[model samples]
Target chain A: NAGVTQTPKFRVLKTGQSMTLLCAQDMNHEYMYWYRQDPGMGLRLIHYSVGEGTTAKGEVPDGYNVSRLKKQNFLLGLESAAPSQTSVYFCASSYPGSQGKETQYFGPGTRLLVL
Target chain B: AQSVAQPEDQVNVAEGNPLTVKCTYSVSGNPYLFWYVQYPNRGLQFLLKYITGDNLVKGSYGFEAEFNKSQTSFHLKKPSALVSDSALYFCAVRDSSTPGYSSASKIIFGSGTRLSIRP
Candidate 1:
């Protein structure tokens, strides 16, 4: 079913460069999320959307912006990439309700390196 | 605010031996706990969850976790560890109170513990 897929599985960007990471899911889930995993820091939420048109800030959303223009897609954009933003990004989706009570399916993840 | 803690940074065990990964949580109301496993360079995989039921929750790969409400802990356990079980494990929690649904919708994850089962 291709539960979740991420585009540009690996990318390298120069300082000040901009790029977008795309996430798509065919599960028809109502909730989508963006998270970054770093060494010793674990996984920190970047942004999330409850529905097609609603987006909310997560634990660490400073250097990123997200758009949920379509139900099956969620996009994360970095206006200007920095070394601090280099990390493995993961996209997840789940059914509606309290997040802890539901199962979140995650994508393969994109490895971004900003030099 | 809801939070999760995995006290151990790494856990080592021999194959065929019992293993345990500790986890503790804090939330305003009732807490929904979860466990996820991640392999090298891969996304997190859902292992199991505790919503409302028996304290002993069994999950995939013969893994189980015991929920202790009084101690506010949900420790993952396996009777016989396998070499393939070596990976990163995460503990997460969220509040179940209706009044805190907005904030509770967010799952707070712990720092994660690396499990190494030697052959």
Candidate 2:
């Protein structure tokens, strides 16, 4: 199994450009999340989906949108890319319950640059 | 609100010596704690977690974490430091009652701690 896979491993976009980062997981997890990693800031949640066809806002959802139309796919979109939006994006999923039971599994990550 | 704190920005250890990366959390009610490690240019990898049962939790790569409920802390530890272990570590937490933890809560991560192993 491919665990989790993120597409567009690297991309560069100009300000106001639009793009979408795709994340697919074979784990059949009910939860999926998008996070951005900035220097010195660790990882901050951008958006999440609790199940197929459901999505919700996260801590840093200002410039992003998400969709989970399929059970295995979660997509994060940048409608208008800004320099501040340039960072490494990660996708994670987990099975909730027990301690250590919900350890989130992360994707390889997608690096985006906005100039 | 649930949050986590990694007090040290960086930790240095001599190869073969024990290593520790401190973490503390703030949340009402029971807390689910987790530790993750990130290597250069890669995604964060699960190191360990503390949900319940024993206070000491063993995880991948010979790493473990001690959950001290009284202290609101979950510290990651290893018997020996390896140069290959040098990387960024993060602590995360979520209140057990949080909806996100059930079907809606997203994990909140700490700023991160950079660990270095010196030969």
Candidate 3:
């Protein structure tokens, strides 16, 4: 099973350009998340969707939007890319529960470079 | 609010020696703690987690972490260090009090710890 897969593993965008990063998971997880990893700052949540139709803002949701049209897919969109937004983006998914069983599985990552 | 911290930015251990990467956390309710390792340019890989039962949780690759409520720490440990074990480690935590039904779950991660196992 392709636990999690992200499209456009690498992308380069000029300032003000817009693009969308797609994430898909074969596992029937109820939770999907988008995160960006910076140099020393750990991964920060960009946005998240708990189910197929619900989305929520996360710690760093400012330059991005997310949609969960299908249970297996979560999309993160950048309306206007900026140099500050250049980072490695990750997509993850997990089961929904209060117990410790909800371990998030992550995709390789998408490297975005905004010039 | 829930937060996690990894005090050491870099940890160097000689091969065959025991290794410890420190992690501490603070949460409103019971802490759901986790450990993940990231290679050069790869995504974070789940190592282990502490839920409810055991204070010492063993995970993949012979790594383990001890959860101490009194100290608010969940330090990752390995009996013997190997060169292949060198990588970046992260500690994450979430508030267990958050309702399970809520779709908007959030987890806070520590900055990260770079572990180097030398020969």
Over B1-119, each residue of candidate 1 has an lDDT whose tens digit, in order, gives 67889999999999999999999999989988889999987899999999998999999999999999999999999999999999999998878874532552468889999999999
Clash pairs detected, candidate 2: A99-B51, B100-B104, B100-B105
Docking band of candidate 2: medium
Of the two candidates 2 and 3, the one with more favorable DockQ, higher being better, is 3
Error of 3 at B96 (Å): 0.9
Model 2 residue A107 CA deviation (Å) reads 0.4
- DockQ of all candidate complexes: 0.61, 0.56, 0.60
Error of 1 at B38 (Å): 0.4
Segments in model 3 whose C-alpha atoms lie over 4 Å from true places = A99-101
Model 1 quality (TM-score): 0.96
lDDT over C-alpha atoms for residue B78 of model 3 = 98
* Candidate 1: tens digits of C-alpha lDDT, residues A81-109: 99999999999999876455778999999
Look at candidate 1 and give me any clashing residue pairs: none
**Candidate 1, lDDT over the whole model:** 0.92
CA RMSD of each candidate after superposition:
1.4, 1.7, 1.3
